[model samples]
Target: MTEIALRAEGLYKVFGRQPQEAVERLRAGASRDEVRPATAAVIDASFEVRSGEIFVVMGLSGSGKSTLIRMLNGLLDATAGEVELCGERLTGASAAQVRGLRRRRVSMVFQHFALLPHRTVLDNVAYALEVRGVAKDERLEAARRTVDLVGLSGWEDKLPGELSGGMRQRVGLARALTADTDVLLMDEAFSALDPLIRREMQEQLVELQSALGKTIVFITHDLNEAMFLGDRIAVMRDGRIVQIGTPEDILTDPANDYVAQFVQDVDRARVLTASSVMEPARATVSASSGPRAALKVMRDLQTSAVYVVGRDRVLTGVVRDQDAIRLLRAGTTGLASITHDDFASVSVDTPLSELFVPAVESPLPLAVTDDRNRLLGVVPRVTLLAALGNVSSHTGELPTVEPPPTVPITVMSEALDAADAESGRAVPSGAQEGAV
Candidate 1:
């Protein structure tokens, strides 16, 4: 059975006296705008997060992203409704219970890094453990390991003032890691860093998430960041959740015009994964097959290349039609010796945008592999262009998750221009040692 990390049901938070009247009115078919001047910080916002998933909560300023995250950790009390943390009700828990849960179960990463200015990086990170009454020696050891984990191995002795904004943020993250909490609540954790550093932090966070598998509730205003990191995103507006879906789902099928406009300028390549552009491979050849037989198979399929697989369909290498024919005529026996690893491979989860350069650079199609390195599909260069081309222009149709067969040749030029423009802005994958 799937373990749910957290769940919020009919959650509502309102500030000011006589809150129940406003809550009742809002619940009885009243709009948030109508209940204005009442300070409805959150209204009937409910969602569930699966264990080990990065759940992102995003909205415009005043959309209640921060409020929602605060409520999740019990840092802010909900006026009404229940919050279940790891199947236990956190809503009605006493202040002491909430404090205990926070100290042991939840760790938060704030936007403006709250590193202790007086302490060194190592000491700042260890402070969280120290608060829990952990021994000084043990906390420092744990803090040192976390500092290394966050790529801050050499600067453990430096104070917060001695480090740049990015380095300080890493220290903050290292502090959270030291706690070893099951749930992480991050509120605009990287919003302050410069573009390059922010991107690096984003990548590192994804790396750590992959390694640690901590259930995370990340709050952000950046849609691109949310799309890149979120396993599922909940978009809020007017103190209410408007939509909840995977990035793919939100991108391809926005809930309304508000969302559609929000993502209009987004660079899709970065957000769309390899699975989005990947198509069925043309053909496959057994490692035992002779070069002549492989050439014949390519001819039958009317293709230029085929992926070669060893026993159990484990991918070996790619065999081009020309290579197959040349090897056969040169007296080569089978595919084992003739196949080449010229093509780069990515996992099904790799974003389509990262492949833009590799697609243009490599002659062979990109192979998509599974956990065991079994061939799942191939993302041909043309398929990638087709996917990008279909969205580059405001072509009449709504964008669908499915990739198109072929796009106009102009796709290459337009895609490049868009890619460049998207890089400077904060518009916001995968595996098998894939080359980008």
Candidate 2:
């Protein structure tokens, strides 16, 4: 079971004296207008961050996402509700207690690089350890190691102004890594960089997460950024969370129109995984099934190819219709002669965008498999294209692939549905073709 590193329940952050009264009135069904102008920065907010997972809290201006984050780290007192870190409750903790927790257990990265202009990069990074009164020699050693970790190896002596925007961000990241804190709080840390620089930072964060396994609470307004970095995202609206799900969940099954509109312009192809788009094979044959049985199953299913599975449902290979017939005439007893591994196979979490080139080139449908290489579903080229096209439509753009004569969008959904029993199908615009 995954362990939770941080938790917040029923949290509210109204910036006024009547917080309790406001909460009571709202709970009693009073219209928000009746609450007057209390600036309810956050209301009834709750979320959990799992150990080693990047959890994102995201929304546009005035959504209270930033306020919620402040509450989590105890930078701001919660108007109501509770927050626990690791396991220690913070709702009523003293100022010193919150400061100690922040200093020793969690680190925050600001949108601005926050590098000290007067201090060298090395001194700036070691400042955290210095604040704790570590010996200068010990602190500098630790700071050097962290600086190298963030890719600022030789710039230890340089001032913040000497570095590029991305480099300065790296310094901030290095500073956060000094004490090996288990949790990181990043509030729009990449929002201030250029687009290309921002992408680089995102990639670096992924690599660092893999290496460090820090529980990160990332804040952003960009859906694309949230989708790219977060293992799970909580979408906020009007100081309240409207949705909490993986990127694919938010895209395919939005919580409501508000969420749908917020992400309507997102690039679904980039965020969607193979597991989201793949459907089960409409027809499959066990390795023990003879040529005749395989042929009959193919004929019944109306597909030209049949997947061959072994014990435990491991996907051994695929058998085409021509091979099945040829083996039948030759009186082949088992599926040995016709089976081939020429088809493409992808893991469930493979991004749909990664499949674009392979999908177009492969003659056979793409197989979606689990960790044990067990067959789950397939992604045919047409089905893949159609899914991409549908996302395009959501962005108010034309789909790139004109539907071919043999395939229609409605038929695609039906085909996927027929195959989607164990591994649900992913269609362009929710089409249901049986498993690919």
Candidate 3:
């Protein structure tokens, strides 16, 4: 079972003279407007971040996402409810206890790069260790290694003003990493960079997460960024969590109309994966089966090719109908001579956007495999298109191949936009199909 690294239970942060009274009024069948003077920043917000998961809190301006993050780190006190870090309560903990916890276990990365102007890059990175009273040489060595880790190897002696915006952000990241904290609270960490640089930082964060396995609570207002990075996302609206789900869940099946409208402009192809549309492989034969048997299986299934699998359903190769017939005519009994590994295969988690090139290039349907090389299913071109267009295929028949469309993803996005416009929703005037 996966261990939970952080947890928030029925947390509320109200700002007013009589804050606890506001909580009571709101809980006792009163609307937020009823508690006029007191503003509820977080209303019964509760969620858990499993170990090593990127749990994103996404909301628009004035949604109280920033306030909620501050409360998690104990920078702002929660008016009601509780927060637990690795099963230890934090709401009622003393200031020194929270300070010690932040120093030892949790770290934060701010949107604006907060670095000392006078200090060198090395000194800024080692500031946390300095506060912990580490020896000068020891902290500097640790800082040096962390600086190299963030791709700033030679600029250790440079000041913050000498680096670019992205580089200074890297310095801030290195500082957080140097503390060796297990949990990271990132509040709009990449929102300040330009589009390209912001995307690059998101990619770097994904790679670093894979390497370091830090539990991250990433705050962002950009829907694209949230879908691309989050293992699961919590959507906030007016200080209340409207929905919490995976990207595919939010895209394909939104919890409410608010969430539906918020995600209408998002490029579905970039977020949906092959697993979402893959059907069971219709024609498959065991490797030990002879050519006659393989040909019979193809004939029964009405497919031109049949996949060959070894023991435990491990994909060995594919045997086309023509090859099967040829081998049978040649009097060959075993299937090894006829089976060929000519088909394209992708992991089950591959995005639908990435499947386009291979789906168009491959002669057969793209094969889906698991980590153990087991053949899970196949994604035919027709099925890929139907999914992108949100067209349901409930006929329970094998998807037949069609002539590959030129720029299918773009066409699908335009189709979605037209549908949204007809429904009287504002369609964003741009199409980006490969953002994932």
Candidate 4:
């Protein structure tokens, strides 16, 4: 089981003269408007960040996401409730203990690059160690390695002013990493960068996480960023958590109308994966099977082609009815002579957005494979379009499709119409034979 790196139970952060009393009243079902003077920055927020997971807290401005993150790091005191970091209580811990925890266990990267103007990149990164009273040479050595890790190697000697906005942000990231903490609290860390730079940073962060395995609680208002970065997301509204789910869950089964509208604009193709819409490849024949057998299976399943799998369900190639019949008539008993390996294939984790080009190009349905290239399922063009069409009904608006490069919009529209017309009959009624 994964370890819980950070946990918040019954967290509430009220700002007013009588905060605790306000919490009691709010607990008794008092609405936010009723507690007028006392603003509830966070109300009954509870969630856990597991080890090596990116847990995103997402909400618009004034939704208490920032406040909730601040309280997690002990930067702000919660009016009521407790917080634990790595199994250590942080809510009532002394200032020194909290400082020690921050120094060794958790580090934060802010929206604005918080590098020192007068200090060089190396010095700014080493500052985290300096506060811990590490020898200057040792801290600089550690900072040098961290600077290289963040891709700002030669720029270590330059002042903050000498670097670009993205570079400065890298320096800030290096500083947080210099501490070598197990957890990172990134409050809108990439929000300040331009769109292109922000995407690059997000990708870099994912790469870094894969290598470093740091538990991250990323706070962001951008839904796209959250979907791209989060293992799971907690959506906030009016200082309360409205929904907590995976990107697909939030898109497909929103908890309320508010969440539905919030995610209406999200690109569904990017969020939905092949596994969500894939069906058992109804027609499949063994590679060792003869062309006559392949043709029989195809005819029985009412499919033009049948996927050919070797031992252990590893996909070898595909056999078309015409080719099989031709081979059979030409006295070819084995499928080895006629099997076509030119069909398109994608991993089960592939997003629906990537299926269009392959779906358009492949004569057969796109094959879904595992790491071992074993055929797990198949995604038909009709199934892919039907899934995208379903996206419109859920969002209450036409899906915003940016047709892939080479696939025309008119072609997608026609396919979508056919899919809608064939609704429940997406997958043909055939027995799943030899499917793993």
C-alpha RMSD of each candidate structure in angstroms: 12.3, 8.2, 12.8, 8.4
Q: Write the per-residue lDDT of candidate 1 for residues 64-116, one digit (tens) a residue.
A: 88888899989888989889888778898999999888888889999999988
Would you list the rank order by TM-score, best first? Answer: 3, 2, 4, 1
Q: How does residue 333 of candidate 3 score in lDDT? A: 80
- Model 1 gets an lDDT of 0.81
> In model 2, how large is the Cα lDDT of residue 272?
85
lDDT of all the models against the reference? 0.81, 0.81, 0.85, 0.85
lDDT of 4 at 169: 92
- Candidate 4: tens digits of C-alpha lDDT, residues 1-436: 8899999999999997789888998899998778879899999999988999999999999999999999998999989899999999999999999998998889999999878899999999999999999999999999999899989989988999999889999999999988888889999999999999999899999999989998999999999999999889999999999999988888888999999999988888998898878888877899889865775575555556789999999999988766765665555579988888888999988999999999877766789999999999998776777777763333445534342222232332333334435453342333223211
lDDT of 2 by residue, 123-175 (tens): 99998898888999999999999998888999999999999999999999999
Q: Which scores better on TM-score, 1 or 2?
A: 2
TM-score of each: 0.78, 0.87, 0.88, 0.87
Task: Give the runs in model 1 whose Cα sits over 4 Å from its true position.
Answer: 153-158, 282-302, 305-312, 316-344, 354-366, 390-436
Better of 2 and 3 by TM-score: 3
Cα-based RMSD of candidate 4 = 8.4
Indicate the worst ten consecutive residues by lDDT in candidate 3. Answer: 403-412
Q: Total clashes, candidate 4?
A: 0
